[model samples]
Target: MKCPNCQSENADTAKFCKKCGTALSKKSINHEEMINSMGNTKSGDNTTKIIIIALAIIAVVLAGAFAYMFMSGDSGANDSTSNTAPAAKNTTKVNDNQEKTASSEKTAQPTKTSMSILGGSFSTGSADADKTYAQIYVGKENAGTDVIVQIYYSRDGNSLNNGNMVPATVHNDGYLYITSADAYLYYPDHATINLYDSSSNLMDTQSVSLSPRSGTQTF
Candidate 1:
């Protein structure tokens, strides 16, 4: 190539003549085109860099949002668990208290019972130490109205003496009496009584022990 302005000979690819500092004819145009191409390439590189940077920023933003949502969900779950814990505890406590109250009520209820009879004996004479008289007393026993009772006495195991119905006794109080004065018996005697109700139901079988007469004996 040759520089037209200064008529200087130069290399074909050179833009300026080395001898006279003049521009080469075809090299000047090629150099300007290369500069424009380099500028355009630099602009395209910068655009690609900007796009990549924008994508990285968007990815960072999306990741931050996802993390925040996950944290919030965990926090909500924890809060829900915490809130329900007391309710569950209170429900259990109430159930326990109700069970305790039911048990207490069952414990407070009275047991069922039926009619009963009790008996005692004493001496009839004033000074003689001989057991003579006997009584079967009924206090407020749990029976029906005007509950009739029959008493049978046995001095020995072989014989039984049946007595009359005990005075049409109410549930409140009554008595059945036996006396050696009527039967001519003596001391240290023992007797057994079998009691029955109006329905012929056997109520009780009790034994009476008569002690000899003494001044200090407590009946």
Candidate 2:
């Protein structure tokens, strides 16, 4: 390039004459245009840098979230795996408790019976140990009604010896006497009395179900 004011030779990049310091010509490029271009370039570069920085930050956040979720899931899975024996042991304990409960239920079923006759009421005897008399007042039984009577003993109602119902002497007042001393009476529990009717039927047999006084025969 040439400096027009001083007629001096200068480099192409020169904007003014080296000799008199005058502007040589319109610049090889417009100053304002260059400044605008530089501004545009700087803006583009800054935009690209910001985009890269944002991408890097997003990547780091994604990686951290993925690691947290993966670690949490793996920790839970490992914990479950490690506790298998205790879970199975707990199941076995529950099964044992259920078995014990079942055994208790089996023992809770109805108990064995102790009564010989289900509803029949019986005798009250003397307090003396040697002279224990066994009798229930028949006059008070069934409101002292004068009626035909029957007595059942033991479990079965029809058998001859073990379970039996027999005819009893009836008074004019209608009191049923299963055992009358006037008729040589005896009870079924006492085996020693060998008395009998002239027909030789067993006479010493007890007629009714007896409830004893004092001391539980309590089941």
Local distance difference test, each candidate: 0.59, 0.46
Model 1 alpha-carbon drift over 4 Å, by segment: 1-26, 31-35, 98-102, 120-136, 140-203, 206-219
Clashes of each: 0, 2
Tens-place lDDT digits, model 2, residues 51-142? 99999999999999999999999999999888997999999999999999999999895632211111223332343122222222333223
Task: Return the clash pairs for model 2, or none.
Answer: 125-133, 188-206
TM-scores for the candidates:
0.46, 0.36
TM-score of model number 2: 0.36
Q: Tens-digit lDDT track for model 1 on 59-162?
A: 99999999999999999999999999999999999999999999999889573234556544454555443434555565544433344444433443433334
- Positional deviation of 63 in candidate 1, in angstroms? 3.1
